[model samples]
Target chain A: MKELYNLGLSEIDIKNIIETYPEIKDLTDEEIAKNIEILKNINCNDKHIRNILIANPYYLNRSINDIKSLIMKLKEINIVNINLLFDSNPFLLNRDSYEIDEYIKKELEEGKKLEIIVDELESNPYIIDEK
Target chain B: MIVDELKRYMLEYGFNNEDINKILAVYTFKENEILFFNIKKINTLLETLGYTQNDIVKMAKRFPLLYSYSMKNIKQKIKDMQKLGYSYNDVIKIIKQLPAIYGYSIEENIKQKIKDMLELGYSYNDIIKMTKQLPSIYSYSIENIKQKIELYRLMNISHILVEKATYLMQSCELSFARYMFYKNKGIIIDENNYPKLFIDQLKFKRLYGIDNKTLIQMYNYDEYFSKEKNVLIKI
Candidate 1:
């Protein structure tokens, strides 16, 4: 909780985060610290981490193994800017790796280039869910 | 600087980069030139007209061309719709549903469409309600709309149902073909299963053992091409 305050989340931000994902209120300070450490392991700076928490507070409730595997899957696809991708579309972090791979394959089958797909997924990850 | 400002404004309003690229395909920003239109002013005008941020986003997404129109043109378009007895909220609803309404002309397209619908035995109130339901009806040609209504009459589907399911006005040939198929199958398509008329072509084929091409030719051959007496049919 002190770390979230250190990240500069306002009272309203904290309140809204708790209201949206009430389980955060039940997590221990150490568990919250572990999640933040996992986010930093993915190269998210403090500001990017703050934006992710605000955009989708459910990330705080995600298990460390689930978060690590999702990051690894995204990295396997050569997504270089995982920080910006998750910061903009944190909900995408919840997607299974197979779903992501299938979306890429479907787009490639439709004659889209790999580079364009990766860039699109990074900037506008919503297109993956549209598949 | 104006180009950057415009890009920033569009991004803030939730227009994705792909949407911006599509818009840029139609309009370009010249270097070292003052812009003639202002997207910011247009956003302010729409907000002033009681459109919420999401409504404006949805409308612009539907018709990115609206961003290219000058503020004066957009304002006049809204006022013209208002003059037609549509309240501000009603106009907003129409625009949200059919943002291409911004591109239509007052004298030739909008008013003429309403007048044509009135001449087609639809009361003014009916026209209003129907347009509110399906503003794309404003863009449908009079001949095409008449063909749709006539097909509904032939199907024994009431104009009231057409008003409720205005999408029935979509493809006349497709509707006629579906109607004939239902007739041949001794199946009645009332309000209950009118939606089945628009089933996917693959599903329709799998269910009825008839594809779209065969169905159109089987039933709609004479009526579909009767307009061109000497034209060679190429199905």
Candidate 2:
């Protein structure tokens, strides 16, 4: 818990993160520190960062550069609520970014707002059914 | 393998290839995903019990939750229900009417519910009768059940009100929003009247002086700090 605090996780964030992924209870303090660093590097807010971490605990293990590039792609496609996007579907990280990029383009073409598209994507990352 | 079998099973249930593909695409149930619960095992059990493919499709579609449920948990629930003197027929009826209950942990969730019902001054037979009267009873969490019960008790609502109209207790966002809206207006629901104060959308509009969409917005917003935000919204 102290390690999580040192990593800048608020009490509520730590509580919710643990609640969402109890398996993270066994994560070493070093692993948690790494997760904090990866999230902070992406300029994610504490709450939003917690949402991302809770949704995809594996992000803790991923190279910071991998997550950094994916987040950049998501931003370029106008995902207003990047945290919500991850919170809605953690598997977004595992899925092919090219497929997600194409889906975002289609949604944009349909005249949907960035927030709406992000909200829908959060719930249905495979809305385009990109296999 | 499980996905293939599920697709085949859905096809056997008369689902078109398009329907099968759509459902499989939306619901993530790959072969490795069913490690905790074998889909084939439930299929065999349900088939042996004489449930047609149509029945399974209806149950699966309406509830949209089966792959996550373990056969062991479901069997344990059946065993628990039988111990309570409910026949297998009764259990089937319960599941058919409300499939979501099939996923609830019998030992943890349902046991706590039965305990809450008992605490609410309902007898064992009365509880069974309540279940029959309202299939929605199984859908509520025990905490929400207790919260509503506490609020009802505060407002002097009778146990019979809860016993008869099960919806009076279930607290979804819309329901809770409506509750706050009406309560603020000092609109006390007539416990004796069916659709007493809140029947349909029209009644909601008439009583609350708000449109359905706005009411839905309020409901949606309650996903945050409900009690506090509701007061702010009302003001």
Candidate 3:
């Protein structure tokens, strides 16, 4: 909690996060810090990191390896604006990499260009959601 | 000591630690300046102008830079809004709604924005009407405003809808993509039925009889659908 405070989140912001995803309270503080570090390594600034956490605290529960491979898959599909992607839709990183790939594959099979798929996902990322 | 005092005052005024941090981060004052003095002065001015301390707190929270503007600048901005024909109460409403209006210059931004909107065929009343509803209109660049209005016009959306639902000004690209989806789906979007253009989530599923995945496909493959239609026409 202090780590997020030092990162400029208010108590209210942190409280809102915990209220939305109570499971987050069970994650060790170090685990949360590590997830934040992973985001910073990808060039996400404090605001982006804050937005991602607020949008989906589940990133704290996901393993570092899970996050890295999801990022790798996104990069493989020429997703260069990684910071914006996760900032806009933090849940994107929570889904299984295979699920993300299958959605992209389905879109591509429908004759939609890869760039268009990537573009739409960035703008309206819920397009890739299972629901 | 001054920073601590200011923080304490903000806390008493209902600002959270985050709000205080935002003000401290964005407001750059000279080292020798009496920061707390300036804040108290702004608070007094707002109170003198009929705002309760609670109203001032809400305004500052919505636009934290309210602490940074000089008292004179705040007065002039209010007066300028009045000069534009808003009554004193209307000016108060504008400030309460968009304290960020203090940040915009009269000639460079607000007046020019109105002029541009006027040139684009909106009457003075229309501009006033929309701005009263969405005070952020003064902050948006004329080009941004023009693009949103043009997009709505292309979709056969009524000008009155933009006046009533000012939030429709935001998200031009998403709106365009949705417009394409509506066009392909044969969903008519006019002033009366335009809400269909924006219900992008579950309500959309219930309303359109299509599931989320189909809606996503339609929005994502709008270009493909257009091409397929073109090819069919040629065939």
Question: Best candidate per DockQ, number?
Answer: 2
* Residue B183 Cα positional deviation in candidate 2, in Å, after optimal superposition: 7.0
Regions of candidate 2 where Cα sits further than 4 Å from its true position? A1-131, B1-9, B16-41, B62-73, B169-188, B206-209, B212-235
Model 2 chain A lowest lDDT segment of ten = A122-131
Candidate 1 on B1-235: residue-level lDDT in tens? 8667767767887766655554544345433122324566777888887887777765654444556566787788888999998998898778776666666667765786688778867788888888877665664445445656666655556465436745533344556677768867888777667767766555676898986556756775344544444221422
By TM-score, the best candidate is 3
What DockQ does each prediction reach against the true complex?
A: 0.01, 0.05, 0.03
Which segments of model 3 are wrong by more than 4 Å? A1-131, B208-235
lDDT of 3 at B96: 78
i-RMS for every candidate: 18.9, 11.4, 13.7
Q: Which stretches of candidate 1 lie over 4 Å from their true place?
A: A1-131, B29-33, B188-207, B211-214, B221-225, B228-235
Q: In candidate 1, which residue pairs clash?
A: none
Q: Give the clashing residue pairs of candidate 3, or none.
A: none
RMSD of each: 21.7, 10.8, 15.5
Q: What lDDT, from 0 to 1, does candidate 1 have?
A: 0.65
Clashes of each: 0, 0, 0
Best-first order by DockQ? 2, 3, 1
Task: Kindly indicate the candidate among 1 and 3 with the higher lDDT.
Answer: 3
Q: Compare candidates 1 and 2 on TM-score and give the better one.
A: 1
